[model samples]
Target: MASSPLGRPTRGTTGTNRLRRNDRWIAAADAFRRAADPLVVDLGYGASGVTAFELATRLQRVRADAEVRGLEIDPARVATATAQLEEVRAGATSFPADLRVSFARGGFEVPLPDGRRAAVIRAMNVLRQYDESDVAAAWRAMAARLAPDGLLVEGTCDEIGRVASWIDVDAAGAPQRFTLSLRLADLERPSIVAERLPKALIHRNVPGERVHALLVDLDREWDRAAALSTFGATQRFLAAVSALRDQGWAVQGGRSRWRLGELTLPWAAVSPLP
Candidate 1:
């Protein structure tokens, strides 16, 4: 018999639009846009396949052929998602009737039929339960299933999807970038993302850690940019991010992405201390 799925069940927490930020990020990713086969996997998609449906809906706008495969370790979750998909197919749900989405039983192994490799594997909030030591192995298992130049996006987000952060891992299982995205409206500090960080950097947010230092500088600059709040939260965030770059953080992206409350940096900039 085939080996069992390679991960534990998730907490099953999910809500509509809870992963909207990540979906937007993935939809804009080159891995999906330029893939010969835009097969994306929503690994460990919690108790609901709503995320998968939403992902496909968003991606279809960019690539009509984009397909999403929602994978769960629990057979019951798979059944439930399959049932929901039936509703979608019948036009009882808001999703398109021809939405290219499917559900299956899988985990980090990311079993795909016909030996098809994925262009992008998104694992939001999936690794929060695993030990930090388990992160590298999980990354390898998931990344190994990627097509050439594919991407593995792993991260955590809040229940309402207001605050989020994720890492981009290449097919080699090597992390490339770290990104923090938030809802700038009514935001207190950028460091709020520390709570929802990926397992790899969650516990590393302490003194002397690069991530810790990044958050500290981010918060400090946000405070210093308080004068710009009168213009709007977006202005304040832009000023703060510009200040971070001035301070030599090597912040990525231009004003467009920053206006969306996103800050990205090379993974090495915030990698855990040795």
Candidate 2:
């Protein structure tokens, strides 16, 4: 018999559109868009498979042949997701019948048959229960299963999907970039993302840490740009992020992305201190 799945069971909390921000980010990713096979993995997709369905819908818009495989350590969760997928196929659910999605039992090892490697692995909210020290190993396990040009997006988001953050790791298991995405409407401050950071940096948000400094400066800029609030939260956020770049934060992405309340930077900008 096959050995057991390689990770712990998730809390299985999931909902419709809860990962919308993450889905859109993955859709825009070069790893998915340029992959020869474009096979994406939704690792530990919780108690429900809706996130995988939603991911396929969004990615399909970018690449018609995009496919998503929802993997879970719990065999019961896999059965549940498979049941839900049947509904989707039978046209009982809102998703398209032609949706190219499936569910399976697996974990950090990302067990794909026939020596297949994934183009992208999305592990949102899967590491919340893991100790920070376990992060690097988990990243390596998942990244090692990726295609040469693949990427691994690991991070967390709130239940309602308003606040989110993720780190992009290349196939070699090296983190390439970090991103924080928030819902700007009626937002308080961008630093709110500090709470939803990936496991690797969540504890590092204290003072004397790069993440801490980034949040502090981000909040400061948001406050400084308060005058622009009259133009709306979008414009205010744009101004705040632009000010951050001017301060030598090495911010990435342009106005179009900033308008969506996303801020990305090289991982070196916020990597925890040794």
**RMSD of each candidate?**
0.9, 0.9
Give a tens-digit lDDT track for model 2, residues 1-274: 1268888988998999999999999999999999999999999999999999999999999999999999999888989999999899899988999999988889999998788899999999999999999999999999999999999999999999999999999999999999999999979989889889999999999999999999999999999999999999999999999999999999999999999999999999999999
Tell me, by lDDT, which candidate is best.
1
lDDT of each: 0.95, 0.94
lDDT, model 1, position 191: 97
Candidate 1: clashing pairs of residues:
none
Worst 10 residues of 2 by lDDT: 1-10
| Predicted structure 2: lDDT | 0.94
Estimate the TM-score of every prediction.
Answer: 0.99, 0.99
Clashing pairs in 2: 12-47
